[model samples]
Target: MNIIALEALTFGLGRLAAASRKHGCSLTLFTRDKTVYDYELSLLDEQNIKVVEIDTFDDHAVVEMIRNEKDVVALLSSTDTWSLHCLDVSKSLGLPAQNADAVRIARDKYQLRNRLYEAGLSSAKSQLVDPRKFDNESVIKDISYPCIVKDTAGTGSQNVWIAYDKEDLLQTLDKAAQEVLRGQIAIEPFFSGTLYSLETLSWKGETRVIALTSRITSQEPYFREEAFSSPVTINHSISAALEVWIDNVLKSIGYGNGFAHTEFMITDTGFEVIEINPRLGGVQIGEALCQSLDINIYEAWIEMALNKRPALMDVPLNIHKGIGQLIIYATETGEFSHIEGLDRLSAHPGSPRFYPTAYSGKSISTIVDQRASIGILLAEGETSEVALLNVFAARNKIRVVMKG
Candidate 1:
């Protein structure tokens, strides 16, 4: 089978490349020249993955290229910006795909919230404010205090802020307005609880949930993720309740064939949707899921693209050990000179897998969003606690040296 992957920035590129090689399938990657970094280009070169550059904004050009691929069996992308394009191209080429409108509903936070609210499903009370014309007095009266203000189309927690009072709320809006587009910013009454991710793979509207991951984020007000571990030990009833709720959400959105990564909170009131990403989790979450469950979701995704329901291996419900991913963010502002910790962490018993995004002489800053993340660390152990301990211990051993 021949598969064309759009937008190589997503972590899925490497995984998809591996899966293609394993399945004896050919893969081609399409990337926008301006958006992809030099290092990413080199990695694609080393992997012998073909890279084709085109203007992503040119819809006619994109459609022409998709139509030109003679033996293309599937068109896929794990990026938010290019998702609708991929789906539309696939639909034009007569391939199986999710509803374009449904995917938009999943990607747009305000739409998702309103849809859930209309359906009587649990969701945060949110209001949208025009960033350009946002007035504190009028907006404040509309929304409750202690709510979160976020860019309506923001991702990776780049433009998300929490406001505990009126002053904080005004300040947050002032900062967020500069980052978001002209559209309204979403302000929602905060829901407090433990956060978890529910991952699913769907085939023709039949959803099969594969993993339930427990997430740890930086302390209140910011949504920057610190770590994630899976096979989260939840009681059967709680798991069942969450799964049922997620299924209803997916059904309501008309989620068809593809992967859905939904993050929700287990609150005192009930389960509230955080965001429903219509793609695989970024970072090493996919890798963590593979390690924890011993199932290759990327391969399954490819198989599903070929109109075959992948026979996912039946992983035992009770996993003795936990598999986790820890992200290391830059703590200083300067040019990244070098790092001292890989050898130490590698030699340790943790069996860590490290992916360093910052190279020597690269500019670094205090991480406020996922883009500022400098590296990632992966570890596993006999228990969730043990796994987390190893991860933190290894992180403590490393020092990210920066040049002032």
Candidate 2:
């Protein structure tokens, strides 16, 4: 049997390929650009993993390709960009899949906020704004100052803006008007607090919190994800409360199966919903889960795709260690050069491993968001806090060189 992926995250392709083989299936990935997975592909064996270059965004082309495949058992997509499209294709072929309507709502931030607010799960409600047509009067009347402006279907923090005052809001609106957005612009109250994500797995409506990751972002105006650490430690009572809250959040959205990466904030009042992704967390989050829980988490993706219950749902999760990942970004936009101080990682305490996301001779642009990231450094320690510190120490030694 063969398991096909519409597209996948930048990392974890190797593990997914291995998981498919473990389940007696070969993996075929359809993507417009194969270079996006260069880091993962370099480490994977080609015998069981196949990468086909095509316009994945072309629905007709993707469906036709899948139709021609032999013994296709499952269709999988663990990305924000293609999860909904993957669902449609899977359903058309009578393959097992999640609720398409639920995925749709989850992918739209404007809709997701309203759903959560209507369910009384969130204190803030979102307003949809046309970037080109929206006026300051209407925006100020609907949302108060210090609100957030972002693409309803954005990923990787590509178009997020924080408007602290009237001038800032107007400037942001003007800036947004000039850019191409993946979805409608959404304006909502900004919730201030520490940012965290809950990595979860659900089977038949039952959700389990696998691990908690702390999201560290760059300084204000640009929410570039700088670093992440998994299995964050929290008080027993708060952790219990979050478990209940997340279950309710997922239930409200009708998310029944697969992995969910729910980002939320612990505000002074209570926990607030940021957004929920209906797939595995991106970057090295899957790797972090595997290292902390000591299991092949991607195997669960294969299991779920085949309509079988994930064994991970039943296994006892005893976190052995903490995992930290730091995104390495270039200081300027230009031609990519070599990364400096990688040789010093071997002397670090956490056994740091460097994964390059960009290669030499590639053109680099936009240093604001995840687009600027060239690589990621991962490390481990006794706890998530220590792991973060260790990764930071390793990061301090590395410098991304760019020639403009």
Top-TM-score candidate index: 2
Model 1 agreement with the true structure over 1-404: per-residue lDDT tens digits? 67888774445466677777787777877777623445445556455566678876566787788677668788777877777777777777787666788898887788888888888786545678876676668888856667888766667777788999888888777777677452358888788888988888777777777778878898776789888877676789987887788888898878866788898888888998888889777777787776666656688767776777766533354464677678888777778776676888767665877776666777765576776677788888876657777887788788778786
Q: How much is 165 displaced in model 2, in angstroms? A: 2.0
lDDT digits (tens) for residues 297-334 of candidate 2 = 99999988778899999999998999999999888878
Model 2 RMSD, rounded to 1 decimal: 1.1
lDDT of each: 0.75, 0.90
Worst 10 residues of 1 by lDDT: 34-43
Per-candidate TM equals 0.90, 0.98
